[model samples]
Target: MSTTTTDIALAPGTWAIDPTHTEVGFVTRHLMVSKVRGSFREVSGTVEVAEDITKSVVDVTAQIASVDTGNADRDTHLKSGDFFDAEQFPTMTFRSTAFDGETLTGDLTIKDVTKSVTFDVDFGGVGQDPWGNTKAGFEATATVNRKDWGLTWNAAVEGGGVLVSDKISLTIDVQLAKQA
Candidate 1:
């Protein structure tokens, strides 16, 4: 059982994440036919490691209003109570609680609802960018019921189907720097 990183280290140097190079995104079933994917533009997070990145930790948070799907009406609808209700809950947060090799358990909060979620986190290890900054990368993905947090709005189909599925898959590609 990985414990809280109370005394986390900063590897041995200072580095920072390239927000333009990171992605915080999600995927959900749309009309039970195709899937929709979107990402946030304004996201901030941090990562800490000791010597090497293998014993590192990460925490991240994102702004809800920054969600965009390339459509104005659809984005408005998503901001309503049917989905994110961005007006009320302006932010979504994820704080890593434990890191066990390939699995990471953390608290995920959205729309005022909080849940303990585990993600299959695969580390890409640390490397140097072309500009010469030390960076560590990781990708995490998980599926959870959207209705579990009261995002239950849906419409019944004429022949008997629902507008949206309950399961939503979230994928995150985090690029962390040691922080200067």
Candidate 2:
């Protein structure tokens, strides 16, 4: 559906992403039977809330080296040349091109490859914290083929399938604070 002006009803201004209160996470099938989850610990971004909410813009950056999957060894490997190659590509970014109230379409970049991806957004509404700070919450998810972004390192299992599935699922829970 096309995005309407009133789809996202928010005050017209700049809304900064509160990294401390946000989570950018992902899930991937492991060994064709299980799943592995991880998240980036450091992220920062902003949303330009235009008078017409549908025209708003979103840009976000995430530190690749800050990836955590609960396993130290796995985290290290993920940063190595086999996976993200964090040393060469230290960050991944997303810039929104459109929002249809429920879906966000954007360009996602990783390892120098850029691809258009869409996320289903779940609005959590706006609220004020104890400090009286106005905040808007949203939960978004998307799925993409990891190989499209050069994240194609895998090993074959003894029984069947590869060690990692090509598809990666992304989950983003963000809280934006209205900036004065």
Candidate 3:
């Protein structure tokens, strides 16, 4: 649905992300031929909407050690020094710097490296749940260079290119419960 200033205005105030219904995921090309996808099991965030919708903000964090690609061995490798080094950098975070109805620009920090990124957000509308809780939903997506975040570890494939692609696609589907 197209989100208007009016739609956002209706969602003003602080909302807590419902991790049980939210997903923080990523995808990247593997061996330059196939794609690999994964999601973090643990994520926490907050969305604050100001009277002026453009001033809204979002802050989120994901535990690196909770990344799951389905394969145990791959998950271990992802948490090792070769990639996220979960022992040293246990978390990755994002804090929004700007929001203008359709676009949300933010600072993303991974492995202690922070970079500015933009995501296209789709507001799924605001409503009340069966429990009578005020809620809002949003789906956001962005593409970023993994190398920029110090996730540069890779192996050369015999055919060509590397084992992992530099570009990582991120998708976040969040359901937020408005706080009193």
| Predictions: Cα RMSD each | 4.4, 2.0, 1.2
Q: Model 1, 1-180: lDDT tens per residue?
A: 232233223365434555777888878777788888888777887765446434555667788888877777977888898888899998888877777666777889988888989998766667777987777776888998987788889998777778788888888887776565
Cand. 3 TM to true fold: 0.96
Report every candidate's CA lDDT: 0.75, 0.92, 0.92
User: What order do you get sorting by TM-score, best first?
Assistant: 3, 2, 1
**Clashing residue pairs found in predicted model 1:** 15-179
Q: On a 0 to 1 TM-score scale, where does candidate 1 land against the true structure?
A: 0.85
Off-target runs (Cα >4 Å) in candidate 3 are none
Candidate 2, number of clashes:
0
Give the per-residue Cα lDDT of candidate 3 at 44.
97
Could you tell me how far off, in angstroms, the CA of residue 91 lies in candidate 3 after the best superposition?
Answer: 0.7
TM-score per prediction, in order, is: 0.85, 0.96, 0.96
Model 2, position 67, has a per-residue lDDT of: 100
The RMSD (Cα, Å) of candidate 2 is: 2.0
